[model samples]
Target chain A: MYRVALRMLLGDKTKCLGLVFGVAFSTLLVCQQMSIFFGLLGRASSVVNDVREADIWVMDPSVKTIDVPYPLRALELPRVRGVEGVAWAVPFFKATVQVRTHQGMLENAIILGIDDASLVGVPDAFVVGSIDDLAEPDAIAVNPAGFRLLFPGEELDVGRELELNDSRAKIVAIVDAAPAFAANLTIYTRYSLATQYTNNGRNQLSFILAKSADGTPPEVVAERIAARTGLKSVTSQQLRRESIMYVLANTGIPVSFGTVVILGAIIGVAIVGLTFNQFVMENIKQYAALKAIGVRNVKLLFMTLGQAAFVGVIGYGIGLGIAALFFSTVPKKSDALRGFYLLPEVAVGVAILAAVIVILSTLISMRRVLTVDPATVFRG
Target chain B: MTTATDTLAVRCTGIHKSFGEGEARVHVLRGTDFDARTGEMTFLVGPSGCGKTTLISVLGAILSCDDGEVDVLGHDLRALSSGKLADFRLANLGFIFQQFNLLPALSATENASIPLVARGESVKAAETSAREMLESLGMGDQVHKMPAQLSGGQQQRVAIARALVHSPRILICDEPTASLDAATGNTVMGLLRDAALAGDRSVIIVTHDNRIFDFADRIHHMADGVITHIESPDSSREDAP
Candidate 1:
């Protein structure tokens, strides 16, 4: 019967191919868009991911995502370091300021101030002079992407100078950091120099990046720091999740992607449903003959189910394969598409969604086959 | 008190059937009593809309009647659940349709193997048996051809092979030769008569083709939802001569 079902389904080449197309198109659309949406949300917490050495982050209680920084008073760093289980703490400064490029164009930049002595928050990768060069007066480090944005098509080199908040600043080193969600060039400078450059008042510290002592869990130390200092202390993972949640709550990204996914599902149901129903109707007499010859309804039901399963698995496999290819191929066009990959949970979710689409499409045809009278085969 | 004779393949009594409702209602089978005995080919002849097809449909248990009784192959169809009735049909009955009704996607051999498959035979065994039957019926060369590739007469032979492959006791055919030429009709009728009369099997054919009337062992004439007469082929032939 499964052989019979396959032959019958494949006999009509157009309709069978149409069914596969419907399932494949939906899987590709929903799965690909969802991955991109996830990747974009992940960018909201790139800063948390960039500073790998910190076990926990301390900030003003109102701070939400990394982009929306609530500056802490400089004195809070020593308070956070004094808490038990705190191995060490460093003052971190982040501020948005305008910089005048050599071309005289003013561009927005995110200024990151690492501790002067330890250079603890400096980017992990350096394309030119090492972190020691930051000791030079008015020295700063800029990432490649921000450098290009600040000076389009310029040759990569150190010693590029620019004006920050009316103060002269020199690019002594080049950092290879990913672009943050704020879509601004990131500038790394010494803490005091960053303060002078931004020209903010004395309480310019944005956060306290802390490490846990040996044998002390980050979560416990974060709890102690929060309880003692009356400030928000979140482990790296917690802060990343909070940043993602903030983006989810405050933006329309989910709803926008959600509507497209729903549309894909509906289109799949419509195309596959109509095509399968048409196939069954065209062969109604043959089914009636089989029914009349005493083939049980359950057997026929399984035959239909088997056909749907075949179409679903094939369609989903092809769709997912193409989606993976897209994720691999699209990044070459731009750097923004970097760091995108399909999540395993999303793969499972899309597979289940494809199965549901296939099942839903065949239901009408199954009912039609079930209700048909065997006597219909005898009719003129 | 109905009795099932050892030779009786079917015993249907006072059968009633209707179609549609309200102003469009039609009582297609009105108090019809019919029977077919083992080792005989029975032909039910009637004009269009005379309820010949409907009567056989009821006898085959493809449709339940509005009233009265149908006992086929020793089981009262009304007394059996639908599931059991389906099992009974699979085990004891077969059907042939006028259109040959072969699944177009299947080859002639596969189409003929359907009844055996319905009885839970494996594809390899069913096709082996179907091939032997087709070869015996002179369709050996056509077994692998799809129905669309076969001539009408060849297709009907496959239908006949399908009907007999499962060794069913009762075979019902509706307008079996209405679509064939006179010579092809005779060929199909010859095949059917040979298959049905070979053992304790009974065949009931509802048709308007007069060319194959010579093949029937007993002719049951029907008119306006009633059996008008029952006659043997020998008696009809004597009358004709």
Candidate 2:
């Protein structure tokens, strides 16, 4: 009888495909949008990810996210390093500045000042020149994608020059880094050069990136630093989550993406509900025949639900494959979407939503089958 | 009134049923009494809307009467709970329809195996038994062929195979050969008659086909929701002049 259910569902190719297409469409819409939304949230914390060597970050108490960092006193850097369990600490500077392209087009660029000695806060890899080239006079590293954003359709070069704060700055290498949530072009420079380029007043340190000693948790060291210095300190992971939470609470991203996800669910219900109802109606006689053959109502109900589940799984598999392919392919064409990916949790969430859709629609379709009078089989 | 007896495969008394409501209400069956003896093929012959179909449905326990006593094979249907009644039907009764209502998506053997499947038999075992039954009915080479690939006669034979696969003591057939040609209809009735006389089993068929009445052990005539006459084929031929 289970085999019977499958054959009945597959018997009508056109209606079967219609059901599959409806489910796949909704799954694609929901899953793909969720992936992009999570991708944006990941970008919100790219700064935290870029400073991977640091296990904790110390900042002014008022700073809520990397995007809105308030500078701490330069003396606080050593104070953080002076805390017990602190392995090493380094001063990092972040500030938004305007840059003038060779074409005279001005755009906002985010300048990240890594420590002069260890280069602790720069990107992980360089696509062109090595990281040592940043030691040259007025030299900075630009992300390949950020470079494209600043000079679209231009080849990557080792010595492209841009004017920042009315001072000459040369891009000596292309770094591979994720774009920030704000989509600002990124420039990596030495801390002392960044101070001269940005013209900051005294106490120019925006954050102090720190590492915990071996065998000590970063959260423990962060707590000690916060208790001693009267400044905000958090583990790298906590800071990343805080950044994401800040955007979630302050921006309209949740409402916007949430509305689309709900719409996807509604579309799934409408398509599966109507077509499955119609399919049951068309197969009413067969159901009556089964009932007359002494098949219990519960058995009939299971058969209907089994058909819906098959459609749901097949549709979800196809939708997830398409979403993964979309994430892989679409970002290559646009510089702004370089590091998007589908998360495992988002896939599980979309699968749950699809199951809800199938179960809800199956209940609606089974109502008629449940109340069916087996005597109807005699009418003809 | 017919008392419960081991010789009777089905017995019903004062069966009542109606359809629709208010001004559209229809009294489809009015105190109809029916029975089919074991080891006999009983035919119900009636005009349209005469309630023969409703009477057989009550006997098969597919539909309950408004008020009646329905005893099939020794179990009082009204005394059994609904679930028990369904189980009783699965264990004791087989049904065939006029249109050869085989599921088109299933192969001939799969369609024949439905009764056994509903009876909780494993599918592999059920299809194996169904294949043996079909082979006995001269459908050996057609086991895996779908319904559309078979002739009308072969489809009806597969339906008969399904009805007999579970070895039920009683079979209810509604217009079993109504969709077949004259020769095919004769062939199907022959199969039903053989099934009835094989081992003290009973076959009750509600049909209007007169060409096959010679195959019945007894015939009941109905009109306007009540049985009007009963006839044996010998007496039917004696009164033919």
Q: Which numbered prediction scores highest in TM-score against the true structure?
A: 1
List, residue by residue over B1-241, the lDDT tens digit for candidate 1. 0111348898888889999999999999988888888878888898999998888888887788899889898888888777777788788888999888889999989999998887889999999999998998899999999999999999999998988899999989999898899989888888887877674688889988888877877778888898888867666432211
**Please, what are the lDDT tens digits per residue for candidate 1 over residues A246-314?**
989999988998899999889988988999999899998998999889888898998899889988998
**DockQ scores for all the models shown?**
0.65, 0.63
**What TM-scores do the predictions have?**
0.92, 0.91
lDDT of 2 by residue, B98-174 (tens): 88788888999999999998888899999999999999899999999999999999999999999999999998999
Error (Å) of candidate 2 at residue A305 is: 2.9
Which sections of candidate 2 miss by over 4 Å? A73-87, A103-106, A153-157, A200-203, A213-217, B1-6, B19-27, B122-125, B135-142, B236-241
Overall lDDT per candidate, in order of appearance: 0.86, 0.87
Could you tell me how far off, in angstroms, the CA of residue A149 lies in candidate 1 after the best superposition?
Answer: 4.6
Which stretches of candidate 1 lie above 4 Å from their native place? A98-107, A122-176, B1-6, B21-24, B236-241
Alpha carbon lDDT of residue A264, candidate 2? 95
Q: Native contacts recovered by candidate 1, as a share?
A: 0.62
Predicted structure with the largest lDDT when compared to the true one: 2
Docking class of 2: medium
